[model samples]
Target: MPPKLSPSGALRFETEEHTLCGLCRTPYKSCECKGLKDNLHDWYVWHGVPSTMIPSAKDRIFVGLPPPPDNSSRTKLVKRWVSLVNISMIMGHFDANHWFSTKWESLNASMDARTKLLNEMVADYVAQLPTNTELTVLARVLGLQRRAIAGKVDGIAKEAWAALRIFLSGDWACMSKAGSKLLMNAFNTRDPKKYPRDDPHLERILDSGVSRIYGVMEMGFDKKGYCLAMEPGRRPCGVGTSTTLETSDERLISKKARKRKTTKESIPTKKRRRVES
Candidate 1:
């Protein structure tokens, strides 16, 4: 007799480590494991999944870099997508000759205004994507630039660009520490104001270079982990916790005060000695 099914419809099978297929739970002697595995492989292949892709951890679903964020690959895919979109957007603006210095108040105001406009546009475009569209299709569509042809192609290109922008923004919402650092490094190394010439470091170079264009560095994360780029000068940001945000200035001031107190208490006062001729 066949084993009974659970209330959830899962098959209850006799598990034998040496004899049964873990997934379909069939006995090895007569198992169709090869067919099942091949079917799975084929499905992924059809879907254009990379062989190197592995199942992400449950915590990864929550988003952002893992706690330490240093030298970690646990959230590489999302980070990579976000980074790519960021670089592309920066370069795109430069290509359009929208050059602005971060130090300029007028430019900062304009950046904020443009960000809001772009985000709204991106959302509208993402909503236009067909519900049945596959993730691979969405990714590829977002990667491509819109054609400049008049009418139909132009309309479609605008939508695609918007979708790409939306996707990038969504991924960025869960920015990890590593992701934040990666972006900062990319901006610092790539901006003409910072490098002005070709970067020598290969790894840094990989993050740098978005053409001959120079742009402002409005976005960044403070030590408290706030995205200064988006919000700009807002302070007293909270970290990963849900608690009340504290002023970063206060935090820095307190640290400085404590250091001064410690130095006054710990170090012996140096005595000035008169040099005998």
Candidate 2:
């Protein structure tokens, strides 16, 4: 049966140290209902009760049946039991002597790290594009806000992932949700058909540690992964290199022109024509 709910005034804990909880029937210090009053909604929902309804103190749940209500007291002590349940879920138990626990915090930390890395990679990639083209790609293809292009790390990360997926599909002009979904399925199923083409640019991004792009690209591993704008064994063709090569070729051609000899027409050609006439 459910525990009796007393009027708010009679539920005070000051003179109730000896009085057991009406729900758990345990002393105040040892009561299992501690620290759950604030999370009443969570507790009720967890017990399969509608969020709009107030659950009974002794409601049954998948976790187990509730303790018999203490008829001698009239305080609603359901909160303490919910607190214990929440704590148990948080603190995973041991099987035999081995302790097993969830790494939710670590997973989040890793995701944050990847998000930061992807933001940097996107910045580098966008820098290589023409000024007008960069703006168009940021606005149209990736749907990035102006502030995102201005060093907003989280926004940059999101834009980079979208751009990378689009680029993998050979469509740098627009982002495609279909492409992104296929890429996600590739990662999940390890199917090459759903993966990106064997383009060098796409491969470079995939091999790098921008995991947020694919959620499996561990870029900062061992502190020696390739950046999005750079690739191994390939020198970047910058303006300086092109200018230097052009100047050297011009000099070589000028030297060859200077060395060429122009033979003048012989006057004997005219004499031979006169003799024949």
Candidate 3:
């Protein structure tokens, strides 16, 4: 089937053929075949997403699910979620062993290492903020404000705040939820100072070691495996299942199929006669 063309005129195809022009198979434009031939130099260049679809600064901050990942978009919602969760865990003092003891002590060590790495990342972000910018300006103007203004932020902020209140009320049972929220809020906030000094943000800093541990755990396992560990029989382990396949069984199946196909094709056809041999 002919590949669909994106609004920008870039052909989008599921197969590799789209990499070449539709009219001609050649990578270069010299093989022109009408509509596919113009300015081939610029053809290879990808036209990114339209600016109208792009989320403004005001779009990211206040509250809602982030937009889908796109080539034109600078931030990835999943990566941001992962980073925020890890940071919150670290600041909350969650134990690495609790999540990864089944894996290895070394895994726990690696988790600590990752948390430190994320801390450095947060530090870099914090450092980049202009010292001259007022704390209030920084707080109100952060990514959250942009998202809030743009109407792209999720309703999760209210839930997060509710969880935070529970944590502040001295309920350790709500710690996990609160920590998660703190991380989410941090990513959403333009000003880090808005994160409560005594609890929310401080918890993230304090639990940095643990967050690193969790980050390592997350990185060590694929999504399926991680889900399996979390939900057990409800989800299968992605890595464990892939590794369990027997090569001998696979080879036997392939051999039998090939033999059957060859036997079927070997059924003879009548030969043609030569009159003047």
Candidate 4:
């Protein structure tokens, strides 16, 4: 059976021990983080998931991130297609490993502005897929970039460079027999800005996601237990929860404040007795 994503924050998921944590990702994407164990106290070590505080991939198909709990202040913004189009659109903060500085303000002010652009790109890619199965897209993504035993390819325009960048730098190797470094290298070099507008890699990952890219499906987060799910035999523990959201922001602020306060404190003058020697 598929997972149930509750809008009230009461949800249950079922997947085998070795399977993906089944959140914020497609078969083509990778979960580089850990998930919450059923216990809710200790972290889930095996198949982990990304943080829910940010957007997550949910709904058997598309929708940006997880839909908010019943009482979230951000409710007005739920289900917005652009919310999850970029994969890292979770929490509205651009993850550095994916997007560098200065791209934060690139969100479309109005949906109308992005509709045509996204549609054109997606239609192009969807037409070429021989089989719409998850494995097919995964195969393409892997073939387009790197292979575990064989290593990497030169360019990244074939994988969702325009519509999405699914494979996380750390997680892409989950399906490969080689080290994940190859995946990371391919992802890092796939910056859309680096490629020209004519590049064909920028296309939708799955044909089924058109409605999602167009804001038609439900979305949802949480399940840090994704690392091991990607690779059955790998040692994927301690894939800790993402503290990258507000907690991290607060810590950074507090650190700066402490530094300022310390500087403001007057330094006592050394006693003249030292000169008597």
Candidate 5:
């Protein structure tokens, strides 16, 4: 038969050696058991936990009280998580172009006039660019340009408008200080005399160059036409003899003749019939 267990809660053990204090595992009150218990009691006291298992009304009330409100760190973490989820959902709809056409159309209909204006500015900026630029260059340029523009505008509202335009444009390219400074200065000044009136034209040039740079950057294309940017040495200039001959009339005829012979072998001749309905 199994040995009868001790009646003490959480203290029952199978062996005599294990019959020591459940908490300290030392001989009950004798050894360091009492010291350990006193230390635990002091800890509970410091932490505001009741020393006794049974509670007074005050103890009960304290125990029943909810925890204090979350601190800013906790709140910030929660917000970050929510933001990440929202961003992931948004990213699901966008393509390589960084646009969700359907979402954009719906938004365009509902958005305010300021929002519409910002979107148009971005669209026009992107439209001004040719398809050949590197993407990295475009991203950097766009960010720099936007910052410059925002710095010029005094009000937070105007800066926000400028920022929205940059985001929508999807132009990320590295730009020189000269170009960036020029844009920043122009954006901040409202006076016609201080700033050039030809903003639309200037904006177009900036936007297109930025977009092309971004595309090239993304493709890892060098300043030269070579695919890899880091590689040195000039790429061959003209079409090679092998490439030209491959597209010549003789090559085309031979390919066509081979296809025809293959098709003839695959199919059987059939008798022609008169159409009498």
Candidate 6:
């Protein structure tokens, strides 16, 4: 039951005091049927039913849910009911906390604070790269490779925790029934064989939040805790999650040719067995 749009004539709130919403039967000033969600889809799903219909858990999820604590930063603030234990926790809770909703605005403020000095440092480092000019690279170097294959996982234990956390949380709604079932089994049994590693992309999903060749490899809703394309190494993921309607790369190895030519100082010799003492 979507928000009932009266066919004939909807009740007009003429700034009248104590005017109850015609749909929810609650005061127009405070309509619970409108729901606590920020988006229309959630409202349609959870609060669409009229006041006459019995409200389910979806309708009552935010009835007593507390918001994030007052703090300058999410990292510093202790988590509340918004743990990654369940995906439904995202609604009316995670966004209100500022961890995922307005993270970019906060990050941008921090970037502006030190961009000038940081750029100066980056440029200075870039100049130091061996055979600095790109034109010279056409001769000696074969090709540049991303650290993807060679990179090491940041922390194996933490990576597993993060992957399992996402799968457990209600975020699996978007996934197919079969896929979700498989993920559930893999997580539940704690068996690597249960995972569909042959999928190839499975590795990246499990490695979410762990460091890759670039920054944190990601596959979910701001799992890195924030989203920003700060460097060529790191890029933003959940682009549209932000509430605001916003208007808003590196070099390779370095080496220097030895100035003085030197002769071989040492030679390798095969070890001889001492048969006789």
Descending-TM-score candidate ranking: 4, 3, 1, 6, 2, 5
Instruction: Mark the regions of model 2 whose C-alpha exceeds 4 Å error after superposition.
Output: 1-107, 131-277
Candidate 3: lDDT of 175?
23
Worst 10 residues of 3 by lDDT: 55-64
Residue range 70-115, candidate 6, lDDT tens digits: 2213222112222221223223332424433344334334434433
TM-score of the candidate numbered 4? 0.23
Better of 1 and 4 by lDDT: 1
lDDT of 1 by residue, 27-137 (tens): 323333343333245555667877554221111111111122222221232233233233331222232222212222343233333444434433443344333234233
List candidate 5 stretches off by more than 4 Å. 1-113, 131-136, 139-277
- Candidate 2 lDDT, tens digit per residue, 147-175? 44454334334444543433322221122
Per model, state how many residue pairs clash.
5, 6, 28, 26, 25, 5
Best by TM-score: 4
**lDDT per model vs. reference:** 0.28, 0.28, 0.28, 0.26, 0.26, 0.24
Clashes of 3: 28
Of the candidates numbered 3 and 6, which has the greater lDDT value? 3
Across 64-152, the per-residue lDDT of candidate 3 in tens digits comes to 12222223111122223233223321122333334333433343344333444434434443443344233333223222334342231
Two-way lDDT contest, 2 vs 5, winner: 2
Instruction: Write one digit per residue (lDDT tens) for candidate 5, span 173-272.
Output: 1111222232333233334443244644333433432232333233322222111111011111111211221211121123554355334323322311
TM-score per candidate, in order? Answer: 0.19, 0.16, 0.20, 0.23, 0.15, 0.18
Model 2 residue 250 lDDT score: 24
